[model samples]
Target: MDDYEAIRSGILETFERAVDAAGRDGAEATRRSLAEARDILAADRLRPVVLGEFKAGKSSLLNALLDDTGEPPLLPEAEEIATSVAASVSYGDQETIEILRDTDDGTPGLRVDRRGLREHGTEHGNPENRRGVLSVHIRTPSPLLRPGLTLVDTPGLGGPYLGHNAATLAALPGADAVMLVLDSSQPVLRSHLETVRRAASAVSATDTPGALFFVLTKTDLGGYGEVLADTRAKLAGALGRPAAEITVVPVSARAHRDFLAHGDEEDRAAGNLAGLTDALWAALCHRGVPRVLGGALDSLDRGVRALLAPLEGQTEALEDGTRRTVGELRRRALEHQARLAELRKGRAQRRVALRRRIDTVQEELRRDAEERHARIWDRFESHYLEEDAYLTDPQRLVAQLTADAAQVVGEINARAGTATAAVLVRTAAETGLAMGSSRPTEMAAPTSGDLVVRGRLGEKHRSGRLKRRLRDLSFGGSMGTTTGALIGSVVPGLGTAVGAAVGGLVGMAAGWASAGRDLRNEDRRLDRSSLRTQLQPLKRRQAAHISASVKDICEEFREQAEQEMEERIEQEREANQRLVAALKDTEDLTTATAGTRLAELRERTRPLQELRTRTAELEARTQAFTAAAVDRTAGGGAAGARKPEPVTVPGAAGDISWAEDRT
Candidate 1:
């Protein structure tokens, strides 16, 4: 067995023993904790979700990586089609296929053959997933899947179907790692960068680093070395990471398949499949496994301490010779009640502070968004009025305006979400609440009709026409008279006829110039008016969008924070109640009987003490395994190892302080 398997087995065994001891002793609370720990371990799998734009070779890459023996590709790969449903591949003794459908209809997963995948998982066959398929699960005995790793093939982002993008995003939270596939021949688009940013945000909620990397596919077409380098640089810049720190592996799936069939060294060299595989394994070993192990150990330690705390309290109470009277128990109960009251007051104050901070942040975000919008609007106005290019083509003008607005709105939402998250984290840290990770709500860009500008340019204005006519008549009469007099002085005979003709021509020329000038001016005025008419509504819609988005984020944050605080308070109340009951129970006992009770308590607590010792040892071993795994994989450019933070696990009796205390 590998180190991960060994460590995982050791931890699982420890939890099993704890569960058995707790069950034997009728320790319900301890068993619950043990069950929670076991659940975490049981659900542990390294999930590297593959994401990319449509036709980026995501499927081909997965196929080549999983199937190297020139067998039919495991995943469906088509040049003209895209994946419609998410697919998860894991290890199994026999190949199995199951289709998970929406549970709203009380539909359980339906097991099917290989042909079912094509029917349900592909866009051509599913046609926007009319069958309500949630995801497709495939289990096979691929060596890559043997190490407790699940490869999730999600629908390509930036596809024609909006639901596909949503599906890909929804699959990100459960991911241990995210592999972004990029086409080596194509330059990275704005969509790719935006998707990466969103993915990064989703991954951050889990606090997993070194879990996102890039895979440049389609290298068999050749002359993509520069494209690969450029993509890496662009991605690195977008992510704010050093170029060298970014991991970008180039591979040719076709070459890999050919190499597998012909056993050619050149094809194998061209494929570079080994490089990608190594990266995946390194990610799993150094980051994914260690994270799961650390979390399991933390949970186990918390459970053990919780179990031991009550036993220690009982043992101490029983060993004491002095049996408390009912009056003393009543006093202690009153003290506990007062403490609970104080806690409630403190919690109320903290919540109020948090809300106020959220309000301030919200206001700041609104102001920032307004300011950004104003600047962008000014630029859009200038571009529309000063540049004849956009004025002539309304479609291009509207597109530009829409893009600008979306960009600004997206930025505002991103900032608001970040600020709100920070406030939540700060509040939780200060108030000692166990806050769970929540996915940030994504804001959709405004695509409604309110933003569409519709009006033909050069529409005649009545006032402009009147003004032009008057100006033309005035210029024509004056110029005609002046020209006639000048020609009459220049020549003696035939002056009248010549002068009249020249005068008429000059008048017509002046009239035409005036009319043209007036029409151009009127057209520009109308263009600006049309833009303003559409822009006002666009601004309002954008503001409302921002407001609603920020409000949702704040509300989510508030709800989660309040829930955590309530849970903690409830735990404290329960602990206090338990204390009161214990004291009251002790009040019924006599001093002579206390000796026997103490002996019994010691016997009951002995097993708990042993369990705690075993839990501690397991925690230490898990930590060591994590450290060693990280160190061993460090040469592969994996992130450096860091010690896990000490988590405060609340107990039923009271707050039990258990630190990692790594020495």
Candidate 2:
């Protein structure tokens, strides 16, 4: 849970929060997600997964750990998928992908084809020669499960069994806890080491990245010793270090049954396997799955905290707004009721009294709103802002709003002075317009072209989804960007209340100028927003200013929107504060005292119990993802690492106490 890990986790958590927000129906959902993300910063709940290629004996090793305790997973009797070659995990339900059907074998991945579990009666064997795809699940329940540990099961090294070899290879180095399986009987091949090298390059750490463990499987096979050297040499080559840099061990997993009977691995094959597991577990202590998950959790915590920090101060303000609005509404309603009651009391003058009362309130509404508009007029349509911004450049405002006449792409987000200026230029030659260029000040922007940056996945995004979104906001329609939504509820004549009022003044001047001398008697629509609002000229002008220019802003902001969005989100985080108030009243999350904080924290984490219970159930099932006999020596080049003996062999599945390594 060091700082760097914390940062990584936080960044990822933010992505999750953003995705959740994106899924919501309206901006309210976005706000809620932001709020949720803010709270999560204080409490982190993320598990860092330790994953790798299948036949890495990941299943058997986990089973051994499970067997160490009173609780052990029931490995499935059936088999599927030749070998996991995709990024595999014990749990995760969403973002579903199909298990690639095994062309080689009928069996692969999980099957839900049966109408019920009883469809096969008592038999539950795997489909044969399964390749590609495994299953999609959120979790599995293995007794050894805990919050700090997330164990993943992955596809094998070669391509076919699961899917692309690249997907599997790419996923390896990202693991905090890693173990490379080596077939003790087969020496490392040139192609094999190359794949491993590619996986290693993905890991990056400010200090040091993940550690590597070498497990030599199928020790009973004849090539264990010779292949071990090859495996070591290859890892050293990839890691740019000596053999000592890796942890190599030999194992024979088929001996589980034998060990159960004898309570020990007395045979050489069994002994080697036991020793391997022991050594691997020992070296794993420091870089255990727990530590990785802890780091992930810490990262989530920091992100949540940073996101929510702004709300702590603003909670009071939001509460005040809620209180004031509600109270005002109540008072007005009550007064209206009282007048009605008086009219009812005086029947003789009831009609007249009711009319008078209604008129009075209507007048008050008009007057109050009018007066408020006047008071805030300068803020929204301030001469200072317009003059300052215009002196800065009249073209800035239009650039932010419309499409550029010449150049199509433009900046969608306009700033405080409103949108950047768009020069709406016509070529001096074509329109004989004195404007510097023929380009429309506002350039068209890529609607969903690309706002891509490589984060966790190490994948590039050049898709069109979000680009279209921005494009729609810029050219096709109004109020599509996040900024637009935030201001949608704004009272046009009440501009001073939302963001800077300076832009309003510019619009007011424009409106006045457009109206000409008629402005004297013309309906003066102040550059202020009012409730029960009509589209005021002032509001339109301000919007116009912000979006006046687009080409100048370019696509720079879009590229950085993710970052800007995060910043603006926190900067204007005061939008909601009810939950934040609750936190502060409890002593700013630190608590009034230690005892109280502990209690509050427990209460806050009460929801976690449900999440944990769900995770536990998932852990159990995940452990059984793969529990069949694995021939670690099949692909490995090493002496002494045996081929997977048949169950019917004289001393095989039933009699052998072999602790085989399936690396």
The best candidate in terms of TM-score = 1
Candidate 1 lDDT over 1-663, as tens digits, reads 155566677778878877786677555655765677687787778788898988898888888888635234567786535455678999888888899887676766988776667777777777767777877889988877876778998878665554465457656655677788999877899779977776665455445445666788998998887887788778877888766656677889989988878899999988888778766654454346645665566556555554554455555566654555444544766686676667687877877887798778767877876786677578776555676766665555655555555555555555655576567557656654433322345555554353445665344454567667767867886788677767866788847667866786778678878778878887777877876775676667766776676677666667666765665555445544555665566667788777776787788768767766776676566556544543443444322222333434332222322222121
Error of 1 at 542 (Å): 6.8
Q: Write the per-residue lDDT of candidate 2 for residues 1-663, one digit (tens) a residue.
A: 132233334444544654343334133433454454445433433222333343455445444533422222222112322232332334233222234343556555443322221121112233321222333222334333322234444445442232223234334433444556665645577546754554443232101222345566666555566667767777778767656445566666546545754676365346355454333333232233223232223223333333333333233323434445434444543454454345335534533433343334334333432342343334334442343332233222222111111111111221100121111111112221111111112222222112221111222233553454444334322222223334534747434334233334334444444444333222122211211032234334433333433323323322232232233333223322333333334333232353454454455334333323333332222212111111232223222222221111010001111121222
Q: Give the TM-scores of the predictions, in the order they appear.
A: 0.61, 0.35
Which candidate gets the maximum lDDT versus the true structure?
1
